[model samples]
Target: MKEYFNNIYLALSTIFIGMSVTFKHLFVPAVTIQYPSVKPQLPTRERNRLYVNMDDCIGCLQCARACPVNCIEIETVKKIPDEDLGLTSNGKK
Candidate 1:
């Protein structure tokens, strides 16, 4: 008889706790945003794509070689010493 009452008490306590949590959240303000109607503001420097600075590149081909997917293709041409190829922004020939 004692075990039967304990089981009933445990079941009622569990239900009360669950209902209390549900009712608490029901009164709270909704955090969901209406997608097409309300657009999210992004930062000025947000980078959604990759950017490479060719001027600073040393043509080492290390990036291509290190790619696990082997998707990067790089080709290099040797510049003639007599021709003026010009200097980089950092003054490197």
Candidate 2:
């Protein structure tokens, strides 16, 4: 008889705890952001991809040296001093 009452009390306590959490959240406003229609602008400092500026690059292979994975492969050919390599977009040779 005592065991039966203890089991009943335990079940009622579990149900009360569960229902309290459910009711608490039921009245709260949703925090979800709707995608596609409400696109959030990313910060300017956010870097998602690597960007290489070829014009400014002197083929120094510094990136390869800094990489721990050795994934970057670079080859450079020394241009002849008199050869016109053409100007970059910013007009720098």
* Model 1 whole-model lDDT (C-alpha atoms): 0.80
- For model 1, the superposed segments whose C-alpha errors exceed 4 Å read 36-93
Question: At residue 41, what lDDT does model 2 achieve?
Answer: 82
Measured against the true structure, the TM-scores of the candidates, in listed sequence, are 0.38, 0.39
Highest lDDT: which candidate?
Answer: 2
What does the lDDT read for residue 65 in candidate 1?
76
Tens-digit lDDT track of model 1 for 1-93: 999999999999999999999999999997888977997789988755333467766688877876767777778888787988667768887
Residues 6-92 of candidate 2: C-alpha lDDT, one tens digit per residue: 999999999999999999999999788796689778998975544457776789897787676778788898989899878876897
Q: Which 10 consecutive residues of model 1 have the lowest summed lDDT?
A: 47-56
Angstrom error of the Cα, residue 39, model 1: value is 6.9
Poorest lDDT segment (10 consecutive residues) of candidate 2: 47-56
lDDT of each: 0.80, 0.83
For candidate 2, the lDDT comes to 0.83
